[model samples]
Target chain A: MYKHTTDGLRTLLNIPDNYQIFFLSSATEIWERIIQNCVEHTSFHCVNGSFSKRFYEFSGELGKKAFKEEAAFGKGFYPEKFEIPAETEAICLTQNETSSGVSMPVADINKIREKNKEALLFVDAVSSLPYPEFDFTKIDSTFFSVQKCFGLPAGLGVWILNDRVIEKAKQLEAKKVLTGTYHTISSILSKAKDNQTPETPNVWNIFLLGKVIEDMNKKGIATIRKETEVKADMLYNYIKDSNNFSFGVEDPAHRSKTTIVANTAIPAPEVNKKLEQFDLAVGSGYSSYKEKQIRIANFPAYSVEKTEELVNALKKTIG
Target chain B: MYKHTTDGLRTLLNIPDNYQIFFLSSATEIWERIIQNCVEHTSFHCVNGSFSKRFYEFSGELGKKAFKEEAAFGKGFYPEKFEIPAETEAICLTQNETSSGVSMPVADINKIREKNKEALLFVDAVSSLPYPEFDFTKIDSTFFSVQKCFGLPAGLGVWILNDRVIEKAKQLEAKKVLTGTYHTISSILSKAKDNQTPETPNVWNIFLLGKVIEDMNKKGIATIRKETEVKADMLYNYIKDSNNFSFGVEDPAHRSKTTIVANTAIPAPEVNKKLEQFDLAVGSGYSSYKEKQIRIANFPAYSVEKTEELVNALKKTIG
Candidate 1:
């Protein structure tokens, strides 16, 4: 399962041979490990919405000197200047903000690297993986939980980091800094060389992920990504043309292609109740926007036909 | 699933309302979280075997002043004096040493309580839960992974800690110590109060755990414990009487009723191969004892008839 899944993921995601993939319990745990293993004291975060802000909070809780540049909610982060401290060890960027339905283009990663060549560039591609068309070589690492884009059950988080991350971890361990307990990069990498995890991992999920990826490989990632784009476009066009709702992200270019959140004239809960009458359900706005926004997921599993049905349901509910 | 499982677990394990259960990925992760959240600077570990020693190592990696008193492998720890440091914030004890099959009696918990009045008492009941007849009130916390006594698949660890543990974590937080990252005790408790987890947990396993606990509740833990004892007695008596094998633990009182490890004159691999002819499989000895010992699990799920079959297979293999 390990060899097959690693191979499948590499082929599906266009991951390079230099990059290494390790599976953890969740993307949240990856945030903890990233700070512990890669960052020594300070790291810079570009926060567009909730998940990016949560990563900043995680670094702070781990006793790191966490600095952040924040964009307004429901907006994308555009770095005018990489005005980060020279001693910063890493820079965190969110490719797709699930909470606010905004995404930063892959070009933003190159810009960060242009300013700071040494600091590791980390991306939270939680809701955008396999569909983002990311230039993986530009970033040092990226992570995602399976429940989002893969349409699998939660419990497994896939973390892809390069050899530079390993070097940084070894440097910290040599200097007697606390990387972590068992799941530290040095410990995991040592065991991973044997195609194994550090502890008794979620083996069942790993097996299932392998099977899913095998199926995805048969269908071809290009076909999957194209279908996802069409479904996302259909849903987005409906919301844009509707008078009763408006897109959450003001710029069409900045709006997330995976998770589409919209501001509705009716209360979000009320709109959800109307959709429920059609045997359709969608998530309410994240956190504070719960009352005013509705979130729709255009994942790979959501077929073009099903998405069109959902669009029709939304139009009838709004009317 | 949380409410049903919590209720069913409380009934099956005789847990009081004050003892809270938070689920993590594995027992290894629990060791990391326990030391991070419950211990501030110093802690005492009573190490009998490999698993207990691992817990002590975890504390050290997290930068705690970890002190340890060790017993020989396959021997139980008996504290003659409470020689632990006064500043120690937590005391770690392993209820059953899974690697060596030595268990500390429940009565010994009172002896430590008598010495240390304020420190949090944490127990690793990884292979001896819902059948150990533990007086939960005597210890502040105990944790177990479902793959052991619960007879479920791996990946879910249930931690039962009381308010005292929570208070200790809050004190560490107030002092600006790193309690942990996202799954810290305080963060988990805050979410558990709302019957939730901090992140997308392994929801399928949680659902299965609830169903398994409901079945156990119906079977009654007492009946299950009785069967386990019977199985352990059968296996232990066979080892003692057979010329080819002997009990691993020196004293019968210290022998674990859940996992029975026996020293064998024949190489353990040969014994396993012989048993395989009967279509029976047993675990190889852990770590260094791999070739010299055979470990048998006396979990509740191994019914009386199944244990009898295994015993008969062992008799034939020895003959």
Candidate 2:
């Protein structure tokens, strides 16, 4: 089952030969583990929204000296202007901040590696993975949950790491630093060699994820990503023209392709209530934006026709 | 789903109001969490099999001073003669060693409490939880995975801890010691009060577990325990009189009622292959005993009549 999932995921995501995938409980846990295993003293973060801020906070909570180049909610970081400290061991980035519908362009993510050549590059591709064609060799590590782009039930996290991460972890072990017990990098890698996990994993999810990836392969990755962009453009174009709703992220370049967030004149619950009549529901805003915003997930499951139906309903409610 | 699972679990196990239930990935993870949260300096363990030994190793891996009283693979601990050092912060016990099929009698577990009143008592009821009716008030903490007795898919762990655990964790925090981050005792307890978790948990498994527990509740715990014992006695009695098989655990008093292990004259795979003809399968042994023994599970899903069929098949294989 492990081999099936790993092979299927590798093929689906176009994971490069240099990178290896390890499974964990969630991307939330991968945050904790990155801080535990990768960083020795200081780490840098690009914090723009709730999800990005959490990785920074986890670094601090894990007793690391965590630094961040901060941006307001719904804003994106300019990697050129940001300076990671010389002591930074790892730099964290959120490819798509689920909280505010902000995405750091893949070009921007690639630039961080060039600037901070000594630091390990870790990206939270949580809400966007298979949709984004990343040059896996450029990034030291990246992770995501199955519940997002894969359209599977939540429980499993796929962590993709390269050789540098392993070297740093082995060095830390030699220094007698406490990494973790069951899900340590070395332990997970050892089991991976045998097509197993250190503990009994979410077996059902693994099997389901494998099946989902196989189907995705049949449909083709290029087709899926292209359809996603088409649907996203439809939703954004409608929101652009609507009077009652506006783009959540002001910059068009920073707007997320997968998670489309918008400011609503009416409360989010009211918007959700109207959508519920069509048997269509989008998530309410997260954290402080609870009442002010609505989050529409532009997943593969949301077809173009279904998205068109959503847009027409939007016009009827508050054109 | 959190409310449903916790409420259902509390009723099914008759958990005291003073105790709280928090979920994790697996009982294997609960071992690491206990070492991180409960023990500051040292822990004592009864080492008889792979599962219990893994807990002890986790303590040492986390850099704690771990001491243990050793027993052979198939033997039970003699709590009266074993002395846990006064400085020991936690005492670990495996109620049923699935690897060896030796159950430390609940009375023996209760005696550890009488003698080591100061240390926290932690039991790994991994393979034999809801089946054993323990006086929850007498033990400080116990944990189990739903895959075992609940007969559900793997990935959810139930950690039942009393208030005393919180006090110890608070003390450790005050001293600036590192407990965990996301699933820390304080964080989990806070979310649990709201019927929530710190992160997006295994929602599907939690829902399935709640449904399973609800069904188990309707059937009643006493009746399930009685049926398990009846099935166990049937298997054990047959093994006692058979020429091809014998009890895995030498001490009759220590044999498990949930996991029935038998030393087979024929290889376990051959026995399993014979059983497979009848659409039946039993687990081969753990670790070194993998080829020499067969482990049969007496779960609630297996009725007395079904167990009788298994027994008849066993006789046909080697009568």
lDDT of 2 by residue, B1-319 (tens): 8888889989988999999999898899899989999889999999999999999999998989999998998889887778889999999999999899999899888988988899999989999988888988679999999898888888888899999988898888788788878878988888989988887778889999999999999999999999999999999999999999999999888999999999999999999889888999888988889999989988888899999999999898876
Clashing pairs in 1: none
Q: Which residue runs of candidate 2 sit more than 4 Å off their true CA positions?
A: none
TM-scores of all predicted structures: 0.97, 0.99
lDDT of 1 by residue, B1-319 (tens): 8878888988998898888999899999999999888887999999878999999999999999999988889888776654778888999999999999999888887788777888889989999987787787688999999898888777788999998998888988999888877898988988998889998888878888899898888898889888888898898888888988898999887899999999889999899889888888877788999978889988888888998998888887784
- In the range A122-149, model 2's lDDT, one tens digit per residue, is 9899998888788776789999998998
Question: For model 1, how does the per-residue alpha-carbon lDDT over A237-258 read when each residue is reduced to its tens digit?
Answer: 8988998888999988788889
**CA lDDT of A99 in candidate 2?**
92
Cα distance off (Å), candidate 1, residue B127: 0.9
Off by over 4 Å in 1: none
> Model 2 chain A, poorest ten-residue lDDT window?
A129-138
Give DockQ per model, in order. 0.78, 0.77
